[model samples]
Target: MSNELDTLLTALYVDLEDRVLPSLGWSRTHRRGRRPALGDAELLCLAVAQQLLGVASERHWIRYARAHLTGMFPQLPGQSGYGKRLRAAGPLIAAVITELARDVDSWHDVLRLVDSTPLPCAASRETVRRSDLAGHAGYGYCASHSRYFWGFRLYLICTA
Candidate 1:
């Protein structure tokens, strides 16, 4: 809606279409079956925009996009369709992220920052006992909260 956001989206879409998608060998004609109304680049742009706008729920994002971004994205998919496309585009998304990160100046920096957060898988003792994550997940203490949790640690490392 804002001028800055519109500019950002435009620039992002151009970069994706001209550089990222082609480099990944993802041309519009490569896929089989009926062509989607939304192209891969456009879908990826929408995904990035959703993240930038902090719209977490796919249903809510679809509603918001339909209301606010319809001018930019004329043909929008339904919530379920968007979810399926997003799930299927996971590998493409990862590849794009990698490619984009490589272009960032700090990506090659030696200095890095590391963080770990608790990803709670279960709360109840019974649930923990029956959960399939028994072998992979275990009890851990979160120093920040001064509490114990039954989950796996999610670690994130980023360039400084």
Candidate 2:
């Protein structure tokens, strides 16, 4: 891992342990099951760092982490495990981001931007008909790309 990645992981882990986990009741002792080899803080940091690094594919991200980040995340999960963990941690991740954003001193009261994009789910008609996403997915036209997509829309609100 690069020094930057190391620093980010360390700082995030510290903040999570010290500030967030206590309020959220996510301490290791409160968790059940085989007790994940990887802690919640580490998983959250990994997910956020993955997003920050623009890694869109979970499989690719797992492979990259296995090869390059093993030292930082000694117990990195496999693809499926990582997917489940990250999905479970979604709400926590969002909370963490909101908390951190509130501390951004440089951008206070500046222009805030919100944007959204489509999250493609089913492609073919048959797939769309049979998919669990049938109710949530809808036909949407992508004006920027000049194409049609069938999926749920993802709205992102953030400072830009």
Candidate 2 residue-wise lDDT, 43-115, digit = tens = 9888877888899999999998998888888999899999998888888878777777767875576776788
Per-residue alpha-carbon lDDT of candidate 1 for residues 48-152, written as tens digits (9 for 90 to 100): 889989989999999999999989999999999999999999999999999998998987889878999999999999999999999999999999999999999
TM-score of 1: 0.70
Work out the TM-score per prediction: 0.70, 0.63
Candidate 1 lDDT at 112 equals: 72
At residue 41, candidate 2 shows an lDDT of: 89
Flag clash pairs in model 1.
Answer: none
Candidate whose lDDT is highest: 1
lDDT agreement with native, every candidate: 0.92, 0.84
Error of 1 at 91 (Å): 0.1
- Model 1 local distance difference test score: 0.92
